[model samples]
Target: MSAAVPPVRKERNNMRARAALMSPALLIIGGFLVAPLFVVLVYSFLTPGTYGGVIWEWTTDAYVQFLFEKDIFDETLIFSTAYLQIYSRSFVQAAASTAICFLIGFPTAYFIATRPAAQRNMWVLLVTVPYWINLLIRTIAMLFLVRDNGPLNHLLLSWGIIDEPIHIAYTNFGVGIGLVYSYLPFMVLPIYATIERFDFRLVEAAFDLYADRWTVLWKIILPLCAPGVIAGSLLVFIPSLGAFIAPDLLGGGKNLMIGNLIAMQFQASRNWPFGAAAAMILMTIVLVTLIFYARRQGRSTVRLH
Candidate 1:
């Protein structure tokens, strides 16, 4: 018979086995995620080359240039608000999209969650049906729908809603609509998952105690499903903040978000260091937001317990 291994040896062997199993994932994260981020961080601190790429010399010009513009004649740094406006626009758009998604998605998720178990799947399937189509195709379809001579305008005209077609396509309004359409599913799914697991007994008890619909919703339902709501908000808000497609196509190059600004720096402007700096700043903001949300969530959970 084989001899039994010592406890210490067995523990070491188990750790080795675990590490062996994790090696592939570790390598993938290191190679793909971490390495790329490191490269971008390094590039952010470098000087932009005359042509396109970054120079070997390290400098903070890229970061400084974000808030200040250098004059061509005297080369004095002048405070600029153009980039700040773009960032503000992106944040406003993202926040608006998240709020709209929550308003629409909450009811939709509640409807789906309250449905018979057999029917719930069909509702979810319908919700996700749009995703099967390519995003570009869907965006283009939205553009066509919102165009001056499109079916939406035709329908509104027929209903005598307006004297003329409303201009939606190639505008910020169209971009907002596109963002809500794109990320609504993200909000719905998380909320549905949370509400599906909720106990109806508590709701019945609240009703029995003479609690009103709004009271039950605010006190019980919303508090219980806050996790999913927060998750969906993050899912929608983060992507919407960095959204390229909606602003690019719907806004028609007229209204530029932060994503478009970063792309312009890299592609049209040929300012690699500036683009890298923008990306790093965006990443930092997202990280800080995530940390803030995480801590708040932890505190809520502690209070609940």
Candidate 2:
């Protein structure tokens, strides 16, 4: 052996090794995620070309166009509420989906978490089975089920639950149902993971201290499991907000959500800049939601400590 390496030299060698280990991930993120985001950001501020792509000329008209429309005759900017309505509808649908997922998923997750360890894997496998199928196939199947003459309506008629077939397909209600079906597992999995590791002793202690079920749920269980609930909510809400398949197939093109709006811009409308702007706005909303969650999580962690 030669003379021993110096401590600083050894540390430098270790850092080089770590960098080599991380280089692949760094390149992948930079190439795939960051570069695309940069392109979108640049395109959002550019003027739309005559045909489809962007012009090098810079302008904020794409963003302004969301809230204001140029009059057909005068070309004067008039306040427009149509885009706002679409955004509102998207948010409402997303929020409804999140709430519905939580309502159904929490109980299901708790049930799964409470089961014996040997059985928990089976329950989880069942929960995830539907997801293994193609989403488009499942959505189309849902459309068939909710259609006027579909089996669901036929069954309802046979049971005398209704005199006529309920119109669910190609409606907002149908969209919501599709969203819930698509993302319910996202809500369940996180909550189940959290509750699996949760200390049930705390719940028992609360009961022993004369806390009622509701009180224990509100004060102890809910608070401790808040991370899972929040995580599940984010999981459900974000995807629902940007959903394309459910809204497209189930909503029947009658209603337009943000995702649909963006798709129309790029494809039907052929306005790249506007599509980029809409995408950027959607990304901003998601980022803000994530940042808010992070800060709230940090504060809660501090409180616990």
Candidate 3:
């Protein structure tokens, strides 16, 4: 005879309780995030009905419009046949923001990570202080500080540099400044996490071997911290790609990043399918980049090992 089977009822009860507890959070995220994403995927492949409804028929019209009929679909692309300007500009802005964030953040992270343990927390807090301020509020504060009659112009006027105020606010330059400022903390935190966990004695050994500082930086420190560089770059670039208020208010309609285009469709044009298609396109681009980054990082790791 088979051994007596243990009761499974108790095990089932435990499983049910766990699922019940997790259900609420799962429901909320699925309802808000996953559901909307699936809807976008569906909208991209389906037709856009009149009065902002989706037709039940399968079609590629929205994606086609994104590629060919850009003017009719995208607001900033109107009155021009340069169909991909918005996509191109968005790429440029995101790339520039990532580069600048890295250049400015790496050293700061290094310093903070190497400081005395007692001082590290204070420096990290100082780096993060700007994040506590509201994004829109911080962006608007920049506008006032750089506006024609603001402190910058006031100072220039006082120093006898120019008789008239310079146009600093409401420009691409202003938008870039805001992007860098808003995203700086994201860049710093990841790199700090990286540099903090570094094996500093390796650099000291490189120094004992009579290696120059630049050589040690290039061959030892940088290669050792490749993960951090990738982490910080991803953190900075992805979010800046979809930054809304910063470019909208600072660029003053002159700059047309992809984020603004997506927002315009939902809010101004009220075309849900087209907006969903645009978003799917942005998602595809981001996915492609991440795949490439991961592949490269994997290859580097293999080489190092």
Best by lDDT: 2
Q: Which digits, one per residue and each the tens of the lDDT, describe model 1 over residues 75-166?
A: 99999987888888999999999999999999999999999999999999999999999887899899989989999999999999998999
Model 2 lDDT tens row, 1-305: 32588888889999999999999999999999999999999999999877899889999999999999888689899999989899889999999999999999999999999999999999999999999899999999999998999999999999999999999999999999999999999999999999999999999999999999999999987888889999999999999999999999999987999999999888879899999999999999899989999999989978987
lDDT of 3 by residue, 1-305 (tens): 22344558667778899999999999999999899899889977876666666778888867777766544445443334343788887778888998999899999998999999899999999999988889999999988888888999999999999999988788877888889988998888888888889899999999999999999989998888889889989988999988888888888877778888888877777676778898998998999999999999999999999
List candidate 2 stretches off by more than 4 Å: 1-3
- The deviation in Å at residue 197 for candidate 1 is 0.5
Best by TM-score: 1
- TM-score, model 2 to reference: 0.95
In the predicted model 1, the residue pairs found to clash are none
Q: Least accurate stretch of 10 residues (summed lDDT) in model 1?
A: 1-10
Per-candidate TM vs. native?
Answer: 0.96, 0.95, 0.85
Q: TM-score-based ranking, best first?
A: 1, 2, 3
Write the number of the candidate with greater TM-score, choosing between 1 and 3. 1
Q: What is the lDDT of candidate 3?
A: 0.85
CA deviation > 4 Å runs, candidate 3 = 1-33, 49-51, 55-57, 70-83, 160-164
